[model samples]
Target: MPGKPVNTATKNERKLNFWERLYLPEVLKGLGWSIRKIWKEPSYTFQYPEEQWYPSDNYRGRPVLVQEEGKTRCVSCNLCARACPPMAISMESREIDGPKEREPVWFEIDMLRCIYCGFCEEVCPEEAIVMSKEYDLTFQDREEAIFGLDRLLVPKERLADRLAFLRKQQNPQFGSTWEYPRENNRHSLRDLTTDAESIQTEQ
Candidate 1:
């Protein structure tokens, strides 16, 4: 049988005092707090287009490919593309004659779809992709927002701070003391042969 309709409204609610019910005192108090903050606190506002704000190493702004020695560090592993939640990254890979035999023939990132979550940077095993300090992004249209290899690749020298920060974070205890050797990233017979020849010449 249905019991008497319960007084749900009165069950767990606190009764308002005279001042609270009046509401004017609470409103005045809030206004006073705001005014105090405005008068006492320093402004964080910047004059845009005139005074640009430079972000620090830890800032996650935009994902960019690392360009080392005139070529992209990415070996077309596609881990970043797969890890991207928005599916903003797309690429086509082709066989290449190099220490890293596979490279992206065409790589593009749709900035409009990219959420800037840093998933692409995090999943990249080669440390080929990393978050840069370029926060100011403006696009006239959808087509303009898509970034190609030309716009996406940043020289490793220019990204040294970010790379160092990443290394420190990845190896906190070591603090940039540990890094993968260049030789470890290559497995081609050509690279091995070159190394052996160089060793023989030195000896």
Candidate 2:
């Protein structure tokens, strides 16, 4: 059997007066405070459609693929698709005759399912995907919400700000000690050619 329940509030808590117990006075007090706040504080509401608001660099918005020259920067590593929590991203890859042999033949992202979490941007090793500052999205149908490669691809010049911000924020503490070489960006067997030649000379 349990001992008598303790009145934990007996000593610490103050008993409410008759008017306080009615609660009407407290409600009025809260209303008065709100009215005072409304009278004192200036409104921050935007005119919206007429006047657009641009977000800062750190703001996470819609994800877009980086287009370099006439081609995409993505090697179709599937890292972004795997990292997305909602599984909104999908792509089909194909082999191509280039240094970056693998490329996404078809890439699409369903904006309806996207949570704007930025996980896709975080996991892209090639810096192919990044969060843009475009927040105001309107769609009439589900089909329109699904963005294909044509809609997803943003020119590098247009995304320069976001790319620069990512580079600055993701820079390692060791500085440029381990900076990746541009030549290594290629995924071709030609990378091993130099090593093979050096080994042959040594042997």
Candidate 3:
């Protein structure tokens, strides 16, 4: 004996005829739609190199160290290197005679290893390293891809858009709770003049 049917169809399913089975009409319909789009729709593609595309402020292109007042804003804190997942950033810190007592003697980023994850940018307390808008990077060899301070440093004036975008993207609630004091990035707040005055009084 045959097994009983477990389920039955409520509505009758339509069977395809010879013409419908061939699928010529559906193929023609798709071809016609594509042709219409090709003629009517505006072309989005551009001839690169000759015609360069500008990225939006929100775009995360290459990462660059911010330069301010003809000097790198990086405090040599090494937070960015520690935060980098791919270990693309490396630097050597040296003592400097300035408000920021420490500075990176040589800073480098290996573009080959960098995943463009933006982790370095997020962890930087000084906001020294930020994602730039320059995405067109062509390297001939592996050695050439490693960017040093000369290539990595971008003037803060040129990065105004990215800076403003970052400020806008920051959560207001978080910003209020954790107040960012720029002076804190400096190694010391002790004034040299005040120290000298105190020394004179002691003498």
Candidate 4:
């Protein structure tokens, strides 16, 4: 009642020698290679808490809201929230009298749900949100992990390194299309309507 042989082996398959069949030689060879490399090179592992590693500007760490001129750069367009893979970003937009007519009444990013994928940063039209160099995060409770505007807003000056890096490393396909404009957040449908009315009056 035994099943027939599958015969899956190729004709070119080489038979293993006595040492190869045992597999001990191969394991020892791998160990020797690892030990040789370790002896020849400096230790690659960092002594955590004592030796801190500063990541490059290209590294995507915790996401933060960019603040400029005593105001949040975000116009509450909700593009970041929409692009977030884990739906970590949430905000409530409110009508305001400033040049930027719409602003986030309360912007929040749940660190517990955030994957730090940088999708939010890539889709932010106003460059209002960008990844920062902070890697260490610890929360005692669920509420502590939810980062609100008070914890998220970072001064533009402090984030200059990341901003410059982003500008320099823009996608080739985008060309100059994704260039950050400081006044873009100020632009709204009202401005377009006003411009149209002025043009009509002139005509």
lDDT of each: 0.91, 0.90, 0.89, 0.91
Give the true-structure RMSD of model 4.
Answer: 5.4
Better of 2 and 3 by TM-score: 3
TM-score of 1: 0.67
In candidate 1, which residue pairs get closer than 3 Å at backbone N, Cα or C atoms, i.e. clash? Answer: none
TM-score, model 4 to reference: 0.67
lDDT of 2 by residue, 98-141 (tens): 79999999999999999999999987889999999999989999
Model 4 per-residue lDDT tens digits across residues 8-74: 7789999899998999998999999999998898988999989999999999999999999988999
lDDT of 3: 0.89
How much is the lDDT of residue 125 in candidate 3?
Answer: 74
* Model 3 lDDT, residue 162, Cα: 94
Cα distance off (Å), candidate 1, residue 172: 3.4
List the candidate numbers ranked by lDDT, top first.
4, 1, 2, 3
lDDT of 3 by residue, 1-203 (tens): 99978786557877778877889987898899999999999999989989999999988899999999999999998888988999999999999897999999999999999988999998887889999988888999999999999999999999999999998877566556556664444433355556667789999
What is the number of backbone collisions in each predicted candidate, taken in the order shown? 0, 0, 0, 0
C-alpha displacement of 162 in model 4, angstroms? 0.8
Instruction: Report the CA-based lDDT of candidate 1 relative to the real structure.
Output: 0.91
lDDT of 1 by residue, 78-106 (tens): 88898899999999999989689999999
* Candidate 2 clashing pairs, residues 3+ apart or interchain: none
